[model samples]
Target: MNLYTFGKALVKTALTPLYRFEVTGTEKFPDQGGILLCANHIHALDPPVVGMTSPRTVHFMAKEELFKVPVLGRILPQVNAFPVKRGMSDREALRSALKLLKNGEVVGLFPEGTRSTDGVLKKGLSGAGFFALRGNADVMPCAIIGPYKPFRKVKVVYGEPVLMEPYRERKASVEEVTAVIMASIQKLLDENSEK
Candidate 1:
C-alpha cells in the first residue's frame, strides 16, 4: 500500500476503537476528479477523523502553526497536508490548494477557518467559496459528531456534493457561496444531532 493508504489503515485501526468511530455517506464522495471536502471544525481530531473516513485521498489545509512542530512538520506533508496561515488570507496556501484541485485531487478544508471552542457552527470564511469557484470543483459538505469522551461514538457524515457550476457561472458573491456551504454543513450537523 502507498504511504497515505498505510497511514490511514494504521490510524483507523488505532483510533476507531478508542473513538468508536462511525462513518456514513462515503459513497457520496466522488471516485475521481477535483472536489472540495468542507467540514466543521470542532476538536483537533476532526481533520483525521474526516480524512480517514473519506474514500478519496484528501490533502488537508492545516494551520501553519501545526507545521512548525518538529515531528508533525515532517509527517503531515507525507500524509497530504499543507500549512495555511490562519486569520488571514494566505496566498501561498491558496495557490497550493488551487494547484491540487486543478490536478483533480481532493482538497479538504474547514470553512470556519478555525476550531469552534463551543462546538457551535460558526460563519465560514470566503476562502472555501473562492477555491470552489476558481477550481471549478464540487464542494462536499461533511459533519463530524461526538467523540466527546474516549470510547464515545464519533460519526462522520458526508453530504451530497454541491455543484459550483451555477454559482460560478453566475459570478455569485463570495458571501453567497460561503453561506450556502455553511448552511449545508449546519444542516448535516442538525440532522446528525437528531439521530
Candidate 2:
C-alpha cells in the first residue's frame, strides 16, 4: 500500500482510543468523479481527520508555511497535500487544484482558510468559492464538530453535495457559492453537534 493509505490507517488506529470518531452523512458524498470537500476549520488536526473520514483519498490544499516545516514539509506532499499562499489569490495553487479535480480526484479545503481558535465557523472565503466554480467538481460541504477534548467524541458530518448546476449554468459569482457552502456546514453542525 502507499504511504498515504498506511499513514491513514496508522493514525486512525492510534487515535480511535483517544477520541471517538463518529462520522455520518457519508452516504451523501459522491462515490465517484471529482469532489471538493469543504469543511469548517477548528484545529490543525482537521485536515488529517477529514482525510481519514473521507471515503476517498483527499488532496488537501494546505498553507504554504506548512510545507516549509522540515519533516512536515516533505511528508505533506506524500500524503496528497499542496501548498497555498493565503490572503491573496494564489493562481498556481488554484491551477493545481483544478487539475486534480479535472482528473477525478478529491480535494479537501477549509472555507475559512485558517483554523478557528474558538471553534466557531467563520465566513467562507471567496477563494474556496472560486475553487468550487472552476474545478467543476462536486462541492461536498463538511463539518468537524467539537473542541479537542480527550476521550470525547470528534464528530464529522458530510452534508449533501451543493447544487452547483444552476450556479454553473448561469456562471455565478464566487461569493454566491461561498454563502451556500457556509450555510451547509452550519446546518450540519446544528443538527449533529448536540450528540
Candidate 3:
C-alpha cells in the first residue's frame, strides 16, 4: 500500500480505541468500488473519526488555506486530502474528487461544506451532488453524533447508499439533487441521534 493508505490505517487503528466508538449500519458501505461518503459535519474532529471507522480509505477535500502552511500542506496530501478554495466553485477540487472516484477510490465529503458549531445537519452544497452525477458513484449517507473533546465516547453511523440515476437526467436541477443528498444524511442523523 502507498504511504497515504498506510498512514490513514495507522491513525485510524490508534484512534479507534481512544473513543467509545460504536458504528451502526456500516454494512451499508460498499465492499468495493468508488463511493461518495456524504456525512453531516458536527465538529472539526468528525473527519478523522469517520475516516478511521470507515472500512476503506476515504479521500476528502480540505480548505486551500490550510495547505498554505508548510506542515499541514505536506501532511494533508499524504492522507489523500486535497485543498479547495473556500467561497468559490473550485473546479480543480471537483475534478480531483471525480478523478479519485473514477479510479475506484472512496471519497468522503461533508455536504454542509463546513463544520456546524451546533451539532445539527446543515444544508448541503451542490458540489457533492455534481460529483456523484459526474463520477457515477453511489452516495453513502453518514451520520456522526456526539463530541470529540474530553476524550469521551462518540457515535458514527453509516446509512444506506443513494444511487445517482434518478438525478442524472438533465431535467433535474442541481439544487434538487443536493437536497436529496442532504436528506439522506439527515435521516441517518435523526435515527442515531440519541446514541
Task: Give all TM-scores, in the order shown.
Answer: 0.95, 0.96, 0.90
Q: In lDDT terms, which candidate is top?
A: 1
Put down candidate 2 lDDT per residue, 1-195, tens digits, no spaces.
Answer: 998999899889977898988998888888888888999999778888888899999999888999999999999999999999987788889899999998889999898877888887899888777878888787998989976689998899998898677888999899988998899899988888775
lDDT of 3 by residue, 86-185 (tens): 8988889988998999898899889898889888777888887788888878888888888875567688888888987777766567678789989988
| Winner on TM-score (1 vs 3) | 1
Query: After superposition, which runs of candidate 2 have C-alpha atoms over 4 Å from their true positions?
Result: none
Question: Could you give the candidate ranking by TM-score, starting with the highest?
Answer: 2, 1, 3
Between candidates 1 and 3, the lDDT winner: 1
Q: Which segments of model 3 are wrong by more than 4 Å?
A: none
Clashes of 2: 0
Give candidate 2's whole-model lDDT: 0.88
| Clashing pairs counted in every model | 0, 0, 0
RMSD of 2: 1.2
Each prediction's RMSD to truth: 1.2, 1.2, 1.9
